[model samples]
Target chain A: MKFLCGIALIALPAFTFYCWLLLDSETFLSLLQESIPIQTQYIGLSNRLLALVPGLIPIALLMRGAWHLRRLFGLFAVRAFFHEEIAQRLHGFAFMLVFSVLAKPVAGALSSAALTMNYPEGERSISVTIESGDLTTLFIGVIFLIIAWVLREAHQLSKENAEIV
Target chain B: MSILVNLDAMLAKRKKRSRELAEYVGITEQNISLLRTGRVRGIRFSTLDKICEFLECQPGDLLEYKSNVDLTQ
Candidate 1:
């Protein structure tokens, strides 16, 4: 449901920039005077924001809802890879590991992009290179992968031992 | 992923020579029946070695390997 995030992905930065321009510097006039989206320059852009409002709330809620069920998803994944008994106990690790494998890096990229947009250019261009966020997310993903790998390996070994006994 | 046992053949070969081998194997005939039917999870190398010795057959004769293909379908 990455599309659930599409509107927020598009609008959050614009909304953030609009806010920063509105309230941050006392010099809203000069910033507004710069080449900008014509709609934003004219008004509060209320209708555009209103269009986003309905979509944003539900998507945010859905995203969190998906997060809440990650454990369930993990159990399902472990069950796919192993058996019911081992999978039930491995639910948390499986969820985190699989989630990390599948989505967290993309998530980090999106978040880092949002984070990048939040900051000012300052006297220098803000180094909001996609790589900046990608690196951290990649690190996290690898850790999760390793965790899943180690636990799964241990489980397989135990299952093998069970046969021996 | 690797060597898989055909305990059915090995057991059939062994139950003839010594009932003691069957008794000491920590498995009832019923459990052996389940194993023979390929319904077991795994086996120890020690058990495999013992079965091999009793049957006077190599482990390879008891087990075979092939590339694991998706068989769910």
Candidate 2:
């Protein structure tokens, strides 16, 4: 379990850096076009950098979620299954997931606007999208929130049981 | 907080060490110590039963209800 978490912790930032900086512009634009349904002309370096500004919101949220998940896994690796902090970290991760989902459309619109900002005035566009995948993520986040609540209840029960004999 | 553990007194009357009671009760000596000091929240019925059987005492002899005692103090 810890091994998997370690791999994920290492992979997350590497993957993010690759996607954000290392990937070629044409490939990145093609991927963006697939997700955002926006027409792209020749995207300048300035516009790509500008798009990263709005993109930072969801990225930050996801990174925060990963941080909490790592902590939760650390506790689990030590067999602290009912530790109070387990529920707290899980709650934090779940909260981040929900907020990240909520922030996605806003970030997408701003990023779209940023990407197209170099276009002629009438052609510049901001597109807000809510896909089925976003809904699925929202649902999973809500389910995780409920699981966190349940874990808190279980932790309380464990605490009370520990007080006995 | 109102319920006081009289385990130490019971152990003295029974001529049994906390270690002996802990062994008979299948619990740790630390838990036995906790029970003796009245520092525990509660005791399980099975543990209480084992202690009672080992010490030849009733539950009432091992526990006392003291009214108007401030636990926080």
Candidate 3:
């Protein structure tokens, strides 16, 4: 629920801008002419899709993982009323982390491919450099942060499983 | 790294069905089957405690430790 809400908050403005652009013709015409403000529509489509995809993925993964973990936690809840499978709990995070790291490059590659497909001419191509205020930055930042946690937990679980074995 | 769970033997001795134990432990019969076959990653302490309680056995009866045996290897 929180994840969905956060995505809504972040995506709301983009959508609002899109709506504002549509409702007000002069601003919309200016945006269309400028092309810089609307670059998000070009290369940013993938990033937008990613914000929706990845933002939702972690939640889905976490939910599925929580279901798998239900038995493990249920055991604890039934017994001491305080059961959390640390490894299983963190496993979803690890999945999100690994996905986030891979998603960016995958998104970049796909976006680049799409750009090439859409605009073959190098001069006509619409590609944005890594900028400070890019919307991609937010998604990218979230991805990086998730990856860091995933790596840490993954290593910890590996060591723990090794010890258990 | 080398503890062997003798769940099958203990369950056999207890004369308690796997399904019954599984229900009490809040795990599927497949998980109990995994335990019987010793194919689980790790059993929770709570699970071990529950199993011991159900079967009226010590942890030693349910599990055994053999030195330097790496079945996975």
Candidate 4:
């Protein structure tokens, strides 16, 4: 599982960045068009890229947090899960998950606004989706945060108990 | 942290080295050092009994309480 997470920690961002490049670069726009069909025409490259910034930032942060989580799990595989470092990493993962879940709607709005910014006055399509998955992700993030808190308390008690020998 | 250990004074009065006491108690010298410095949170009853037996003294002879409040008041 740790090894798989390590692979994902590296691969997810690489794929997201590749998608970003395909979307942002004119040179790769043809590839993007060929791979994914979209009716909306992109306008004002700078503004579009700028708008995409909000979305990309969260994705990057999410990837970074997952990477940290993977490392923490790796430590756990070596029986280091009872340490404060594990608790810290769990907290970090929980926070990043929360941020990612909350930022999704904002990213969706930014993308929709960016794509339709310069479209014909009456023909622009702005789409906002509220997915059930988003709610599930938010709930999972909250659960992870609660688990982190419990782990923190457990680690503290373990430390105190170890000292009592 | 509030429990003061007088293991060192007892050892000195018994003319016993910490290492010797630790060997007799079947514990490590490092733990003996911890006890002498009052750094350990608590000692096991078996270990304390062993130490007391080895030192020829009661537990009270090797342990003291330093209260934060003034009990006299």
- RMSD (CA, Å), each prediction: 11.2, 2.7, 11.5, 4.6
Decreasing TM-score order of the candidates: 2, 4, 3, 1
The numbered model that scores best in DockQ is 2
lDDT of 2 by residue, A1-165 (tens): 546655665776667657656678778877787556687656777887788778778777877888889889889888987789998999998999999999989999998998898898888889999989889999999999999999999988888888889
Off by over 4 Å in 3: A1-132, A135-165, B69-73
Residue-by-residue lDDT tens digits, candidate 3, A1-165: 334534544564556446333345445335433322223234334433333342343334434433434444444555632223444444444444445444443444443344334444553333323334334545654665565466567767765664322
Say which prediction, candidate 1 or candidate 2, comes out ahead on DockQ: 2
Chain B structural similarity as TM-score, candidate 4: 0.88
Candidate 4 has which clashing residue pairs, if any? none
DockQ of 3: 0.11
Regarding DockQ, does 1 or 3 come out ahead?
Answer: 1
- Evaluated against the true structure, the overall lDDT of model 1 is 0.48
Q: Write the per-residue lDDT of candidate 3 for residues B1-73, one digit (tens) a residue.
A: 4778888888888788999999998878888887787776788888888888899999889888777746655
Model 1, which residues run further than 4 Å from truth?
A1-138, A153-165, B1-23, B28-31, B38-45, B48-73
Question: What number of backbone clashes does candidate 4 have, counting pairs of residues 3 or more apart or in separate chains?
Answer: 0
Steric clash pairs (candidate 2): none
Top TM-score prediction, candidate number: 2
Interface C-alpha RMSD after superposing true interface residues, each candidate, one decimal: 2.9, 0.7, 5.3, 1.6
Sorting all predicted structures by lDDT, with the top scorer first, yields: 2, 4, 3, 1
For model 4, the superposed segments whose C-alpha errors exceed 4 Å read A1-3, A20-48, A77-79, A121-126, B23-26, B66-73
Query: How many residue pairs collide in each prediction?
Result: 2, 0, 1, 0
Give me the displacement of residue B72 in model 4, in angstroms: 18
DockQ comparisons of all candidates to the true complex: 0.34, 0.80, 0.11, 0.55
Worst 10 residues of 4 chain A by lDDT: A29-38
